[model samples]
Target chain A: MNRNAPGYVLGFMALLCAVFGAGVATVHYATRDMLAANERLNHNRVVCSAFGLPVEGRAPADYARAMEQALVVATVPDGRGGARSVYRRADADPPVVGFTFWGMGFWDRIEGFAVMTADLETLVRLRFLDHKETPGLGARIEEAAFLDQFEGLRPDWTAAPDRRVMIGPAAPTQAGNRVDAVTGATQTSSALMRFLNEELERLRALDWTSLEFEPLPGSEP
Target chain B: MSVRARDIFKAGLIGDNPVYRQVLGICSALAVTNLLANTLFMCFGVVFTATLTNVTVSLLRRHIPKRVRMIAQVLIIASYVMMVDTLIRALNPDIHRFIGPYVGLIITNCIIMGRAEAFAAQNPPWPSLLDGLACGLGYSLVLIAIALVREPMGFGTLLGIPLPARELWWHSWTIMLMPPGAFFMLAILTWIARSRTGAKETSA
Candidate 1:
């Protein structure tokens, strides 16, 4: 049998695909539970961090436990005609809401979670969960120095007609609704601010006052 | 040359070090070395991908058609990389997110393909596996060395451990955190390693 024959080539290719497919499938199936657990752990960590809850050195199970015990999950209209989930503290007197939002960054999409005050105009904390931004540059968005600026920033929709948050050069003395952009990552900063504003606009349109809370699966009420 | 396993291993670790001698996988070495934690995980991913891909390719070398051997090698490498990616995500989601696309980009790292074609294609399975593991180690050693320099200087941390002086007086070098710093570090490291080994420089 000629090694270069079309029959041999096709047969070899088919065999290779089948073998590799099996190998990959086996790994995927084996790790499915661990992967789901890690993902849940990561999401819980982000939500907790956004709400100023301690997460360091804690197990993912612990975060899940904390989230379950303290937060109530609710689905709300995303202002895009679709519903998105938001979490609120089950015990807060006035109730604070938290949600994850996505934005375009320098290299790829950035996802973050933010906790907002009961009035829905003030940010309590914002923490980036995942991003593909260039390391050390746009990736600085995840750094505490950059993200901490969002805390207590009150977005005044009247400041911008479209209701997007304004980000500018570092102004430690400046007040109200404006965040200081990461120095070298102006593009990522602007993109994040733009998306936050857009999401905030949509979030503003939602009726947060009367939303009902439901316990997430596998969580206690 | 009758290649023994030790020689194969030493060749990758030193004689034909991927980063210093062959200069094959500098892309990831530069991109992920700023954080020691990230560099270590990336190394694990590369080692896992390379060794398995090599063993798989060597086992099938005879059956793979000459014209389609590259495609076959790629499929095997990609499959192993996907497996590594899944494992990393499951075990360490934080590092997985930090490295993000670079994990998938391992499929394109030249060191894996270079060994598959240059050494693995004609070698026995065990030897090919050694070669792959050696090359991956060589690449990883270089990355770790660069990370050692970059992480402390750039971020005032070692594997995320904050240096005492960082809080007291030491100011982190911001440039060391950026791409230009990686370029400079890689250049210096390759030069030092090659010069020490008396290896002839190849132009990139």
Candidate 2:
């Protein structure tokens, strides 16, 4: 319904819209560095929790302190099934065996972090960091019962690499080192166990003798 | 004034209501009204942008070139949107997060655009501002109404304000938080509003 008054006015309006959008994007850019830091810290806390490292509380403010006690490390594997430290903690010794990884799943991205012992043969702790599977169905992986099965799990996935962490057949009271998978979440359990199995195998192929694990403050020796 | 201030207010509140009548800006209504607190924030941001942009556009309508009116409209809407976006982020960081990018997306809200074009373009500046405010009020009222109905049933609570001694006795409408539930509830509310107002309803 608006009939033109001037051509330049259209140009001015286009220019203004550009400026406004650019301004918003620039604001995001200026804060990009800070946001990345926040995300890194969030990911760290999630990894720590997976490895069962304690945080002060679940509050956002408690994240930095939780992160201070833990660190991230990457392992570059050699052909012999042993991983070398590509990355390690700043505060700790040479090799930090804690690492986090993720992959696509049926519903959402599935990811977690595992903190292995300096020997790389023991999975001392792990946290199911993130997932978007059905809430009551597949999401049980984030719960403690499902995740805790891996605690003190003798890096078995590395050595035996072919076994499944089955919830069926019988209870763990009769088994040697098997995890009792969550009921009603068979697919989720399989995906996680498979992911963990594959990742640990890859870690085992890398050289671990060169890395140092950070000493967790006040952790029982 | 070409359009009366009373008409400005009444048209937005009842007759030409953006949420119920025109169905122009129901996105936020459907998305944010699942919780009372979320609906409240969404409504407030819409109101702020609508009112401010209406005034700015109405003031500039005469000067704006017809060919570039759309572009001019964007700048006015975006400026106000950014101001509100920044203010909300600084004031309520948690809700800012819970609501996330929805607050910024208010810039694209068709309510602001529709009002700017239909009402603000033809009305005096003062009346246009009132129309914007009333439109916002109408949106807020219906959003709260939907939220009041949905939240209690969905979460056994109101606006995340927990009810004491509550049990999960009633089966929750699992759909309420999903996009389909929003469409369903909004459709029902619009039906009620049109039938009561005796106005012909047009789907958004």
The candidate that achieves the highest lDDT relative to the unseen native structure:
1
lDDT of 1 by residue, A1-221 (tens): 79999998999899889988998999999999998888777788888878766554697677877777778888887766677898888677566889888877787888888999767868889987778887667887888888788888888767674444678753444758777777788898888877888888777777776888888667853
- Candidate 1 lDDT over B131-155, as tens digits, reads 9999999989999999999999999
Stretches of candidate 2 off by over 4 Å are: A1-7, A14-53, A57-61, A69-208, A212-221, B1-3, B78-98, B168-171, B200-204
What TM-score does chain B of candidate 1 reach? 0.95
Model 1 misplaced stretches (Cα beyond 4 Å): A54-57, A78-82, A90-95, A103-109, A159-163, A167-175, A180-195, A214-221, B1-3, B152-157, B160-176, B200-204
**Each candidate's DockQ:** 0.71, 0.23
Q: A182 in model 1: Cα distance from truth in Å?
A: 5.1
> How do all models score by TM-score?
0.84, 0.63
Q: Give per-candidate clash totals.
A: 0, 16
Indicate which candidate wins on TM-score.
1
Ten-residue stretch with the least lDDT total in model 1 chain A: A162-171
- RMSD vs true structure, all candidates: 3.8, 7.8
DockQ of 2: 0.23
